[model samples]
Target: MTSRPGGRSARVREAVLDAVYAELIHRGYLGMTVENVADRAGVHKTTVYRRWGTVDVLIADALDHTRETDWPVPDTGTIEGDLTAIATEIADTFTDPERRQVPAAIVAAALQSTRALQAKQAFYTARHTEAAKVVTRAVERGELPPQTDPLELVRLTCAPLYYRIFVSGEPVDRTTAERAVQSALAAARTGLL
Candidate 1:
């Protein structure tokens, strides 16, 4: 089907993203090409080139799409509950083989590409913003103390999960997620966060 103007652009973008992600998973970043993505998405090479201009732009766009669809921070009324929910969501993402590989690949790419670094920053910024909203709400509701630092709380809540996923290359199971949540809560309660 031919793409329209407004909504069709988004559809084309999604198709390109899906194609790029598939190529990334199957062949890694070094092997990914606009021509291959266009072929996979059933579009011409010119279409991909015209839209994204470069491979880095396409990769960045794909990463942004992946994060938007997959990462969702939860709000559960209380700080502890909200954090547990967020931890569970994070654990689930890290444990998913496909999802985990995407971030791993992106990190490798980010090391060499400034565009990749910007994309990673944007993804984390979105997550941090969502988390900040949750923490801010908790403070307003008296679930957390007024002096609580939202950014620090977010770091405390997510650091362990990232550590396990990236450093140890371990699966983030429910038990581990719960432990992280508990540890963060303990520190938060003690006014350390």
Candidate 2:
């Protein structure tokens, strides 16, 4: 099926991203090629090259697009509640089989390529920045201590989830996520974080 030129840009991007994601899952990072993604997307190789310029950029963009959209950070006026919300979101993404594999490939690519590392850093920076705002709000509400480090808190809250997703290869559920959040909150309350 042919997509309209200007009217289907967003749709075309989504199709390309989906194709790239599938290729990443099946072929792994090292095996993924722009030609393969282009063929899978039913778009020309030149179109893919013209749009993304490089395979790393294309893959990074696909990974970023798959992440939860406009997910609001929780601000329930309690640090525990906010952490719980954050943990829930993390668990939801990690437990999804397709979604889980994308990050694994991205991390593998990042370790081997400077461009991938930079792209991953930029993506995480934006995500953590948003998360920091939530922590900042909690601090303002007196839920967390005045000197609480927002970035550290964000890391602490997500460390276990990432560990489980990447290392343990275990399913991340609401229960597991809640535990991570609870652990972070406990540590924070005791000045550990």
Candidate 3:
């Protein structure tokens, strides 16, 4: 039989994952150590090693946990409002110095580790799938055409903000979020998506 959700095994996993996130934010990927994470989690180093085996796996497991957590999908009664809310949230996350380190570290780790790379891809896929609900809702409400691809529209809505944060080194604000939403809406209306 499977273990209960709140059993000792689950608690250990939760503590270790939380420690991994804290360690990653504090020391980044290169400086993060399994011993340090185990210490922070109040577990022995060998326990961490026996389970995760490496720093990359710890980070991957943390990401997997995050992906499984429920994200609040926006429902503002309009496609524009929902899309804007989604884009704004992305801007808010990357704009925060402490929160920004997690994704930055993930990208850095994915470059060197295949496990991290797959985890990163799966994380984004889950997020995009969840956010695509807004587009799907818009179609049901007759705001967007039936042919519009919900996932593609969701990706278009997020792409520009990510481009600014990860590519162009540009400042992202409420106005940037609005622009991204409008651009994606325009694309959807024109059947480009």
TM-score of 1: 0.82
lDDT of 2 at 128: 87
Q: Give the whole-model CA lDDT for all candidates, comma-separated.
A: 0.81, 0.81, 0.91
For model 2 the local lDDT of residue 181 reads 86
Regions of model 2 farther than 4 Å from truth: 1-15, 22-32, 49-54, 63-71, 168-171
For model 1, the run of ten residues with the poorest summed lDDT: 96-105
Predicted model with the maximum lDDT: 3
Cα displacement (angstroms), candidate 2, residue 64, comes to: 6.0
Judged by lDDT against the true structure, how good is candidate 3? Answer: 0.91
Clashing pairs in 1: none
Screening candidate 2 with a backbone cut-off below 3 angstroms (N, C-alpha, C), the clashing residue pairs are none
1-193 per-residue lDDT for model 3 (tens digits): 4576878889899999999989877887778999999999999899999999988888888999999999999999999999999999988878887777788788877887899999999999999999999889999999998999999999998999989988899989889999999998999999777
Q: Tell how far residue 43 is off in model 2, in angstroms.
A: 2.1
Error of 3 at 71 (Å): 1.1
In model 1, the Cα lDDT at residue 106 comes to 81
1-193 in candidate 1: lDDT tens per residue? 5656657788888789999888877777677788999999988889899988776778888878876875556767788888888888778876876665567778777887788889999888888877888889888998777888888888888889889887887778878888998887777777776
- Per-residue error for 65 in candidate 2, Å, reads 6.1
On TM-score, who's better, 1 or 3? 3
